[model samples]
Target: MPSPSRVLKLIALLLDYPSPDVRAESLALHALIRTAELPEARRDGLAALLDALCQGDLLDVQERYDSLFERGRALSLLLFEHVHGESRDRGQAMVDLLERYSAAGLAIDANELPDYLPLYLEFLALGDAEAARQGLVEVAHILALLAQRLAQRESLYAQAFEALLALAGVAPELAGQCYQAQQEAVDDSLEALDRAWEETPVSFTDPAAGCPSASPRRQPAGVEQPLQWVAQPVPQTHPRATR
Candidate 1:
């Protein structure tokens, strides 16, 4: 199988919280969209998102992201929330996911959870191509769900999920089954959010934590954590994805 595209890591970086680092690489990202293996339509959508990011002050971009993903559970970036909600099953699911990352030679950092979409994508980018494709297929329903939600709000972030679905090559017949089955009412209103996130997010990979890994061996200290996998751009250089 062909290896997964480095574009996966690029998308992960862009989907992450808005940072000046993104702005700094705007040119490279644009070049990537122009030359990536994605279909033209998908590339166009992603370009729109990148354009939106580079349009105005970084602060405005950051605020929009906060309003979209932070204030609501509907568009929350945590993948498991869409599947497991707040149920206890989510915790075990997270442990399983962490094991997958550890088995893949990753050691998590930044107290990030196992289910954060960006972190998940970075993990997939480093995996076997078939495995990465399967991983994207596994979550294609959630991608569809989020894409619909974001598009409904006229949010540009929908482009990112749409791009993911394209890469996943999800059969149209099965694409929306789980998404269409979501019948619960989400309460991510202003007041609900005010009471939410009262505590810090937990990170299972924190070496300080005693949570032991079942992997054959532990990742030795001082390694590339998450989000650092994106091959960066160099000035006046031809930009290419490393994978």
Candidate 2:
């Protein structure tokens, strides 16, 4: 069976398509099969919904894109929820997705990202501390992304502040570094956003270079960076846990 992360990636891709017909049809098909629902009823309902939505003027393209993106995100999170507790190895795979994708440009939901908090803390306490640290890094990067995107929006700034606070609660030292980086980036983004607003908000026709949203590439084979950063010390809590 395909992993939950793979399935979610597929959902994210379908949602990112620029064409309405492509987006709506793919989503409807996914919902029908994923839910194991009655095909006829599902098809009829989806058809009506798509027809009504398609009748809108092409000028509303941005609205359609946002709606489809949000829907796909909701479905991906649902898939992650279903697989999170099924098996530790498999659950870790989804957690791996959370770690890698929550980067500076990827728009991850702040609320949804916290779902990994318990798993992250538990893993640090029980599994691999280095691995857990990696997860925290991803969360920090996501916060930075949010702060940059919401630099001038008061609501976004508030939400990003809360997210930073939550991250600090997890691993204070690491989160503090992330919060500082995000604050600096936010300041820069606001300056850019302000200039753009006076003229036209900047838009990009291509994905950011080296962005994780294009799919994470394989890491170079070697000792992990964090392992190099900190020496492995004798466990203070569970001296016996470290073999």
Evaluate all candidate structures by whole-model CA lDDT and list the values in order: 0.64, 0.31
What tens digits encode model 1's per-residue C-alpha lDDT throughout 121-179?
88788865665666676566667777877777777898898888777776433565434
Best by lDDT: 1
TM-score of 2: 0.26
Weakest ten-residue segment in model 2 by summed lDDT: 227-236
> Model 1 misses residue 221 by how many Å?
26
Q: Taking the tens digit of each residue's C-alpha lDDT, what string does model 2 give over 1-243?
A: 332222223322322323555445655544533443223443343344334344556447545433322222211112222212222344445444455333212334433332332222322333233433343343443334333334333322223223332322333233333223222222224455444223221111124422331112223122132211101111112101111
> What is the alpha-carbon lDDT of model 2 when measured against the actual structure?
0.31
| Residue pairs in candidate 2 whose N, alpha carbon or C atoms collide under 3 angstroms | none
**Alpha-carbon error at 236 in model 2, in Å?**
52
Give the C-alpha miss distance for residue 159 in model 1, angstroms: 0.7
TM-score for all models, in order of appearance: 0.73, 0.26
The Cα error of candidate 2 at residue 227, in Å, is 14
lDDT of 1: 0.64
